[model samples]
Target chain A: MWRDALLVGGKDLRIEARSRVALAQIAPFGMIVLVLFAFALGPDQSPLVHAAPGLFWVAVLFSTVLAVQRSVAVEAGDATRDGLRLAGLDPAGIFLGKAAAVGAQLLVLQAVLAAGVLLLFGARVVHPWLLLGTCLAGAVGLAASGTLYGALSAGVRLRETLLPFLLLPVVAPVLLAGTRLWQSSLAGGAPDAGASWMRLLLVFDAVYVALGVVVFGPLTEAA
Target chain B: MAPAAPVPAPALFLRGAVALSGRFPLLAGVDLEVAPGEVVLVEGPNGAGKTSLLRVCAGLVPLASGTVRVLGGDPADVRTGVRRRIGLLGHASHLYDDLTVAENLRFAVRAAGAPVDGIGPACERVGLVGRLLRTPAGKLSAGQRRRVALAALVARRPELWLLDEPHAGLDASARGVLGVLVAEAAAAGSTVVVASHEPELVAPLATRAVTVAGGRVVADRATPRPVSTAGTGVADVA
Candidate 1:
């Protein structure tokens, strides 16, 4: 299963490398969201800095939808899905491979967004470790859940509109926990203060990842 | 009395297979049985459930009723090893548009757990050698993409071959190559089922032809004599 997962994950990453969709389109789109948030909140630096964590996560969330959409779109054609099915890899492996690919892409997107937030919003990271951990856990939760919902609505005509509605609500906890964790980390609150939020993110990641792996096979075959 | 020879199990079997699209029944009742090494051609009119039949065999479509067994196991069930031994070439090439032909073949080979060394020979067999292997699938013409898809099929060397409209976009040479590959696969004891509107193109390679209409088999006959492919154009019966 791990072997197949790596094989599929490698294929996705290689495709992204050549397509440059994430780098050229999705990453830029994320940066623009940051700029838009800055504009919406005015030029006052202090308030923007205070709002940086929330705004950054919002951008990540929106960009995550785009990234997840593209990730699933690669397998949009029936032939690709059929090929994946016929290849005989474990369905859980396929789910993990896709989630891992999405997580990897989101990590890069988040890094860029983090840099943008720091430079544009003048936010400081008081405890870099906690912030990093939060971002990692947050990305996993988002990607796992995003992949599950993506497969759920994969072949539907309204997938583009439906994905956001289905995904946004389920992922609300990730956003909330991620925002609080970032706030605590950036504001020099005690490191343990954000531990509970981190735990929530971890739990979210575990449940969604487990659910995705179990249900993905049946869903792909049925869809 | 001498002991009787054992009967070979069918490569694909569907009994009372029923499938629906929304409220409409696509496969009202589909019962098909293909013995090992048999090359069966499926023909039908548009919306006659030909594609659905193949999808059911490939485990892509869920059965609304009845049972389907491919290689002695239910396709609806998650059987990785069973699926690994089957190759399906649908209307879409299934190649990653962003990846080069070589990369696409490599991915397919790896995914099927086939030997990586088979890639070179498979590409050669499909006539996708040289610079064609380096070109991304998106840049290739439709014919080239079909050849790339066929190359992956050759590399995998699956036990069962399910091809849908395998000759739709190919030129004369590619079509001939496809026919030869189908024949060769069956000769090697692999079961081959092809669903094509251009029946003549596949008729020469098929051992039997089954016609599907109104979500059921309308005709089944042995093709003892090969049909000429000359002047055969796409007939949208199905």
Candidate 2:
């Protein structure tokens, strides 16, 4: 099972690398998103920096979705799907492999976004460690929920449109907690406020991941 | 008592297998008994429940009512091993276009956890070894794609093969290859069921002919016309 996940995960990563969807767009998209936020924030240093966490969370959230959705879509072809069903690899393994691939892609994208945010938008990470932890937790929840949605939308006619609709609502809570954590991290690592949100994000990730283990199988096997 | 009929291994049995679509029973009271080492052909025209019937037998669609058994176990309760014993080749050929033939086979084998000696032999058998060695499936012609898809049978070694139009895109020679492989699989103690509208082709190969219309098995009699008795090929009715 681990072997299958590694193989499929490696295959997905290779596909993304070949496509360059990850490395190419992350910086530009993240920059565009942040620049838009900057424009909205009206170039005021205090306001821009103050809203930096909010803007950062929004960008990361949308980009995380993009990466995760693509990871699942790439593996959802008819032959591949039927083969996977017959292959005897646990469905949970496939989901995990996909989630892991998506998570990695999101991480790589976030790294690029981090540099772009710092350089172009003049955003500073006052709490590097805290910020990274919050983002990782958020990414896990996003990936976990995204895996279930990916499998659900696999063979549907209008899958791309359907994915976000199905996932966004369920992902709302995680994003909310993530946003709160980002706000705290932005407020110069405020000890009291940020800690609780960080804890919430962790719990969100853990719960969603365990839930994914139970639900992803039926979704994958569905038609 | 007469010695049990080589009883290869019951590939599929439906004790009143019923499938309902909306309010209608697409297939009801379908008692289909297929033994091991039999090439059972199902003949039906358009909208005659051929696809639905095959889907039910393949354990794809749930039975609205009735019981279905495959390989001596209830299909619904059967484990992955039982599901693995039933290889299904549908209308699309279900071959991954992006992956090469060998890679596709490897993926299928890995996913299925099926143990086979060598894919090299299967590739050679499907006559895809030369052009298909590293050919991306998307680049292959329809016939080549069909051949590659059909090659799954060799790798799966399934006890029951539910092939829906396995001969559509193939040329005469390719059809011959397919027929031979089907016969060979059945000869090796596998039960084969296929839904086809063309009778001439299947007539020379089928042991029993089962016809369905309006969602029920209307006729399921051993070809009083046997393929062997008629001195053609295997017992099959297309």
What does fnat come to for each candidate? 0.80, 0.34
Regions of model 2 farther than 4 Å from truth? A1-4, A24-31, A153-158, A183-187, A190-193, A221-223, B1-9, B21-25, B76-80, B224-238
lDDT of 2 by residue, B109-141 (tens): 556666656577777777887766688776888
Docking class of 1: medium
Candidate 1 lDDT by residue in tens digits, B1-238: 9999999999999889999888899898998899999889999988998989988888777888988999988766766377777888888888888889899999999998899898888888778888998998889998999899899999999899999988888887777677777877888899999998988677777789999999898899998754333223322210
Docking class of 2: acceptable
- Runs of candidate 1 with Cα error greater than 4 angstroms are B226-238
lDDT of 1 by residue, A84-184 (tens): 88788888999999999999999999999999999999899999999999999999999999999999988788999999999998999999999999999
lDDT of 2 by residue, A92-211 (tens): 777778788888877777777667666665666667777788778877888877877777777688888888888877777766776677666656757567777777777878887787
Best by DockQ: 1
> What DockQ would candidate 1 receive versus the native complex?
0.68
* Worst ten in a row by lDDT for model 2 chain A: A79-88
Query: What range of 10 consecutive residues in model 1 chain B has the weakest lDDT sum?
Result: B229-238
